[model samples]
Target: MRFVLAPSVLALSALGLAASPALAAQEFYVGEPVMKEGLQIVPNYLTGIQMSAHVPGMEMGKDAIHLEADVHAGKDEAHSLAEDTWIPYLTIKYQITKKGSPLYHKSGVLAAMVAKDGLHYANGVRMDGPGTYRLTYVISPPKLYRHVDKASGVPDWWKPIKAAWTFQYPSKSK
Candidate 1:
């Protein structure tokens, strides 16, 4: 009985070890969600993911982190958009600055992408090193052409909004 139990436990341990890397790829929130201009924006980061086989962008690397903006409609929104519904056709740009250091700065526009979780804007950024950094996302309303009748027209989209947060690199939580 002892020999059989030992083998079972060893197999389970091996399985757990094998699964650790997958679990490590999970995302972690950078800060609390920010609600503004009838929108809720949540910032998160995780291990860099492969965007394309030939694209020169964020990919799994020692210093790469995948940044994401989970943009959705907020409660109290006057527009007909449902709360928590993912907003589409918006432009999102990200800027990263190393806290208290003027030497390191990077900025780029996030591309719209869909994952198993949902639609969001994201980009891959390579960090200088482990340290506290500030991430700011500038969001702009959709620019798609739409005809609005007088009876069905809603208010114009909100102005570009900025959401910012500071977080530690090599996120301790992950």
Candidate 2:
């Protein structure tokens, strides 16, 4: 009797698990890339990096906005080898243009790989309602390669560059 009942319960549990909405697939937004010189910067809704913005367990606070930037060698395949080997530093400057909110206007270096594709950056900004924001990302190549010759693994096209992207966060209520 116990064996018969266990099989029925297990089958029902499997059906419920398949019907759960939390297990459904989610679609994430990836922004367009802005080019400057030979570097490329792409923005996205979320990245693999995880960081604490405010006090833990606080419900009422600035919303968490996960941002990421991926730097590429260029369109050509000549620098493909340098993509994974070369590690560069990046600084992200962000500002909320809608109003002078203390939580929104801030700048810092997004110097974490936390992701395989590229550098990851994330923070909790004052985006409780909705507003326009501007972000400028500056990518500086590693100093170790500065003196290294191109033949010794360094790409000849490597250099520091700046890319900017301005976007608006829609109101959550609407």
Candidate 3:
């Protein structure tokens, strides 16, 4: 009876241990996924910014500025069931132009950053997978200087400009 009971008890223990890993995987992947807001989210699904950035006849000028950036992160989940994961990302930016020689350069252009955080669980343990995360962003905004003809020290054909591309996240006000 003792020998039989020993095997059963050990098997039960193993099963309990196994349950931990699957539950743990959610620690990392649970909050974050391909679609945080939901599949097929519309312009009004998010929150944070104002309108005119979304609609027309707004305070912002017709032709706003633009920017782009990319990020690549590789992860090694030696203990994880999947073993590895990688995510490639990109974002397009928008801004308004300098209006009547705005004093601060940063105000003319927005300073921004975006980062991704991740976690993994295996064998009832939580682990930070090697290189599974990254910080990618556009720190330096564009120059808003008036076009100057160096030789003549005079303005170019275009007028002085205040430019910025505002990407207003959709909200209650639309």
lDDT of 1 by residue, 18-64 (tens): 33234234687699999898889999986735454423464456677
* CA deviation > 4 Å runs, candidate 1: 1-24, 53-60
Task: Output the worst ten-in-a-row residue range by lDDT, candidate 3.
Answer: 38-47
The lDDT, on a scale of 0 to 1, for candidate 3 is: 0.22
Which is superior by TM-score, 1 or 2? 1
In model 3, which regions exceed 4 Å deviation? Answer: 1-63, 74-102, 107-174
In candidate 2, what are the lDDT values of residues 1-174, reduced to their tens digit?
A: 001224555566678853322221121344477655544566554312234443233122235455556655455434443443333554444333444455645555553544333345434443445565666666665444333565655455546566665666642221
Q: Where does candidate 1 clash, by residue pair?
A: none
**How many residue pairs clash in model 2?**
0
> Which 10-residue span in candidate 1 carries the lowest summed lDDT?
1-10
Q: What is the TM-score of each candidate against the true structure?
A: 0.80, 0.54, 0.16
Candidates sorted by TM-score, descending order?
Answer: 1, 2, 3
lDDT for 157 in candidate 1 is 81
> Which pairs clash in the backbone of model 2?
none
Give candidate 2 misplaced runs (Cα > 4 Å). 1-31, 47-62, 77-96, 99-104, 116-128, 146-159, 171-174
